[model samples]
Target: MGDVFKALADPTRRAILDELQERNGQTLFEVCTRLISRHGLTSSRQAVSQHLDVLEAAGLVRTRREGRYKFHDLDTSPLRAITDRWQLPTD
Candidate 1:
């Protein structure tokens, strides 16, 4: 999907996805902490939240609210569609 590609085009978003893959079900604060510690990204909490929003719109990220906390998870099914469309033979 166009949205998926667009969302993944950003290095920051890709890093966010990587963070999710490494550790799913992370809250916004957790995500920001890991991004800065692991990737040296000094982005603000609001900026990271906006990146999460884009990823969610593209279906790359899914979020669920548990009381006051919101946890983010990665969904790679959109990428599967792309691979399925042009799958190479194993032979």
Candidate 2:
């Protein structure tokens, strides 16, 4: 949970999550390009890669390797836990 909060604290990381939500299974290059074209973010690929590392550490993002390429996918189960904890029961 602490990791989730820490990962969500950064705007760049949030943008990365949004990108994944918009289009799952994106490569690092695709993510960097989308962040610039769609989100107007000026972060470099290396910086975005670091951001992805943090997101991966938080369990918010999952990765798969295909040959030499790695794809990033979003995982929202941690977020579901937060929602489940706070949802009011119906009478």
Candidate 3:
């Protein structure tokens, strides 16, 4: 729950999740490209990488190495923690 709240505190991370949800298991480059287009500029790859690291640490995202690149996927289990802990209404 701590991790989920921490991860959701950042808009960038949330946006990253949205993208991954929409298109699961995207490569690092693909995630970066979506973020760049949505935010109107390419932030440094290092910056995006850092954001991914945080999300991964929070257990909200998972990564798999695909050849030379890492692919990201959403892990919604932490989100369920949030919903459960908060007792939020879910439809």
State each model's CA lDDT, in order.
Answer: 0.92, 0.91, 0.83
Deviation from native of the Cα of residue 29 in model 3, angstroms: 0.9
lDDT string for model 3 (1-91, tens) is: 2366787898888889989989989887888899989766467778888888999988888899888877888988877776676796677
Please give, for residues 1-91, the per-residue lDDT of candidate 2 as tens digits. 3488889999989999998999999999999999999889999889999999989988999999999999999998888766687886687
Task: Give the least accurate 10-residue stretch of model 3, judged by summed lDDT.
Answer: 1-10
Q: Candidates sorted by TM-score, descending order?
A: 1, 2, 3
Which candidate should be chosen as best, given TM-score against the real structure? 1
Superposition error at 41 for model 2 (Å): 0.7
Off by over 4 Å in 3: none
| Clash totals for all candidate models | 0, 0, 0
Error of 1 at 72 (Å): 0.4
TM-score for candidate 3: 0.85
lDDT of 1: 0.92
Query: Where does candidate 2 clash, by residue pair?
Result: none
What TM-score does each of the candidates earn? 0.90, 0.87, 0.85
